[model samples]
Target: MRIIRAAKVLTGRQGEVIVDGEVLVDGSEIVSVGPRGSAGEAAEVVELPGHTVLPGLVDAHVHLGFDAKVDPVTRRSPESERHLLLRMAENARKLVSAGVTTARDLGARGFLDLALRDAIEEGLAVGPHIVAATRPITLTGGHCWYMGGEADDERAIRRVARENLRAGADCLKVMASGGMMTPGAAPSWVAQYTTEQLRAVVEEAEVRGKGVAAHAHAHAAIRSAVEAGVTTIEHCTFFTPSGHRFDAELADVVATSGTYVCPTVHGVMWRAREVYGPEMLDDWLRGIASMREAGLRLIAGTDSGFGAAGVDNPTDGFVASLEVFAQAGYGNAEIIELATVLAADACGVGEVTGTLAAGKWADLIAVAGDPLERLADLRNLALVLVSGRSVTQAGVDTVTASVG
Candidate 1:
């Protein structure tokens, strides 16, 4: 048994915060959480007098196979499967060290993400609890087609979904529209799959007790995905032929449909400003604000590994997404919820993790200062614990046994 004493603790539920908080852990599960003195003496006690403790973060979208280089596809083409697995293990360690105790990997090649997830669960590697999608289903010559999950018609879509489930995929990821990565593919504003085809995929996944995540960028595709009853929507950018557009009616429908949205906001502000310009960036921010106003459930996710260098680093891209949410007018509590409890719920792990609650996994992080006062304090992580084991301390990584 261990007791973690901190100055403050955010439970990540109902906006609860305990002063001079103490969390009790028995093995990998949390036993209790309350005031410091409430927890009796234990075999081990870790105290932080000036730090705030919170649940470990959950990133709703990520790509473990991506290397975050200039040309990730070309960089990965020549590597053997063994080398690719090695890189993925390294990336997963980086994510865990950065306080991301749980992450949903939306895309990967050759079902490597599944192998990595199992390896971590089997205590062979240290990493976040991964909800892996295996390979994203797409159309012929569509976005991310090189990963080899291409299905055009309803029958093919059902077949692919079944195959992924048989291979032990945690969920299904379907590309409803084109993407920015593949050259000569359909534009982001165009839909790649019909509504019936998408429904087939969703129904098939649901029957197998698996959720479906849809990658949609266009307004039409977003509506189709919402109507198809996908578990979540990724990168709901609402792109048009000219640029980005926001449809309030559609947004209202999405909000009412109980669908979660992952904007996949990256922390690289300078690069975004350079590419989209100030006015355009402001427009994007406004769109996010509008989503919030429409009562849409937004979660924090960095499309890490697609192109932003250093995104896979422990403290860079993930924190940047929170910072972006703050700059867009989210309160400290709301932003924290998006990363912790909300993110976990979106990824379908709410009961197991995401909060400093009894019977849940003792996955949490302690920061030097109060994040409510300044969001940047999150970057000053003092210690990261996943499944009651300390994997990082004061921004440095430490090797620990993998706890499934």
Candidate 2:
């Protein structure tokens, strides 16, 4: 058993946090979490002089199979099986060190991610918890054409889903729209999927008891995916030929269907301004604002392997995302929720992992500043724990302890 006391414990739940709190962990579960001094005495106790603690962050969308190399996977040389395994382990460690204890891998090649997931669970290597999706189904010459196994018909998509399930996938991924990674492909907001195909993929995924993430960029594809019952929508970029606008009806449906909208906002918020120039910045901001206003379930994802600019640490990326939202004039509380409680909830593992509740896993992180005041505090993470075991720590003076 262990106890960690801190000046603040942001439970990562919406509206139920505390200042000067203590958390008790036994084995891998969070036995008790409450105000300071709640647990009389413990086997071990660590004090956070003035830092804040919160549940370990979750990146709802990632791709461990691809190394963050120069050319994106969908456009480059194929990775050797051995290389994929090795790279997956390295990516997981970086994520864990960033205080991202639980990550949902949206897509990965072959069966590498599945194997890595098992290895992490078995303690064969150092890594965070992995929720992996096997190879996704895609249309030929479509988004992520390489990693995606091209399948045009319902039978083909269903067949691919079953094969992925057989490969030990925890979830199913489908390329529902064109993506930026593939040259000559449609932009983030161009339509890519037929309503029938999305429906088929969703139905097959349901039958296998696996969740689906529709990689949607355009509104037409996004609407079709939501209507088809996807568990989450990735990179909802709101792109169109001329420009873009919110699909209000689709937004309402997503809010109504309880689907997760993982904007992976960090990627767009960082790149679009530099890539497209300033004229389209307002368009990008408005679309995101609309999604937030409609109360969609948004989560944080850096699209790390995509050469996503501006930051390195996933935790820092998450914090920067909140700041962008704040700068855009969102309420501080709402912006905070997008990275914490909302992110966990959107990933479909809220009950067991998101908050600092009794019986949940003790996945927590501590930082020196108050995120509620200046979002940058979140970037300066001090300590991180996964399953009650310390993965990284900040010294008394507030610097990350070296891994070695």
Candidate 3:
């Protein structure tokens, strides 16, 4: 048995906080959590004075295969599968070291992410628990077509979905609209697939007990994805050719349907302002705020890959997203939930890993200060525990240690 004592603990559910908290772990699961001394005596006890402990963070949207570089698609194609696998393993370590215990990889080529997932599960590698999509279903010549998931018709879509399931995909990602990264593809605001086509993909995934994540940015695409009943809407920008547009009716439908939305917000404000101008950035922020006001369930996602500006690291990008929400007037508690409990729920793993509750996986992190007071304190992570195994100590990767 192991007991981790901290000055404060954020339960990551219902905004609960425990002072002088202690969490007891037996094997890979949490035995109990409460004030200090609640666990009585343990075989091993680690004290973290002047620190706050909370559930390990989850990044709901990521592409493990893309190496976060300018033009990552082209850079990724030539690499051999073996090379790509090795690179992904390194990326996984980076994520776990930064206090990200769970991650949902929305897209990857050649099913490489699944191999990494299995490796981590089998203890062959030290990394975050990965929920991989395998290969994203895209349209003919649509965004990310080079990954070889292009499907134009219903039959093709169903076939691809089945193939992914056979390949052990945890979820299905369908590109409902074009993307900024793909040249000559449809505009971000243009729908790549019809509503019926998207529905087919969603139906197939749901029938097989898998969730579907739709890559939607345009207003029309967002509406179609909502109508298709996708589990989560990725990049729900509600964008238009003219500028940012928020469709209230569609947003209401999404809220009513209990669909989670990942806005994919991870960029510096000043840099964005330089490109889109201050007025456009303000409108974008207002749109996000309006969605929250309309009862939309928003989760944090960095779209961390391809060396994007603010998404250099999974944990760092997520923290930056929380800061963005904070700047947009979201309270610290609410902002933290977006990356912790809310993100885990969005990725379909809430019961197993989101909170510091009994019977849950002991996946949590300890930081130097209270995150509620300053969200940036999360960057000062002291230790990371995944599945009750210590993966990092004092901001560095260390050999996994058994508590008992």
Runs of candidate 1 with Cα error greater than 4 angstroms are 74-76, 308-316, 393-404
Clashing pairs in model 2, backbone N/Cα/C closer than 3 A: 7-20, 189-218
Clashes of each: 0, 2, 4
Winning model by TM-score: 1
Taking the tens digit of each residue's C-alpha lDDT, what string does model 1 give over 1-404?
Answer: 99889999999864699999999999888999999878889998999999999999998898888776645664444677788887788788878877789999999889999999988877677788899998899998899998778898888888888888899998999999998778878988999988888899889888878788899999999999999999899989888887679899999999999899998877775566776577666777788888998899999888887874322323236887789898888999999999999999888889899999999998899999999889889988888878877774432333423312
lDDT values of the candidates? 0.85, 0.74, 0.84
Residue-level lDDT for 298 in candidate 1: 94
Off by over 4 Å in 2: 74-76, 184-190, 267-272, 308-316, 393-404
Better of 1 and 3 by lDDT: 1
- Residues 293-389, candidate 3: write the lDDT tens digits: 9899998877877544322434336677678887778888888788889989888899899889999999999999999999999889888888987
- The per-residue C-alpha lDDT of model 2 at residue 58 equals 82
Candidate 2 lDDT, 144-242, residue by residue in tens: 766756787788888888888887887888888887677776677776778888888878777877678899878888888888888889978667777
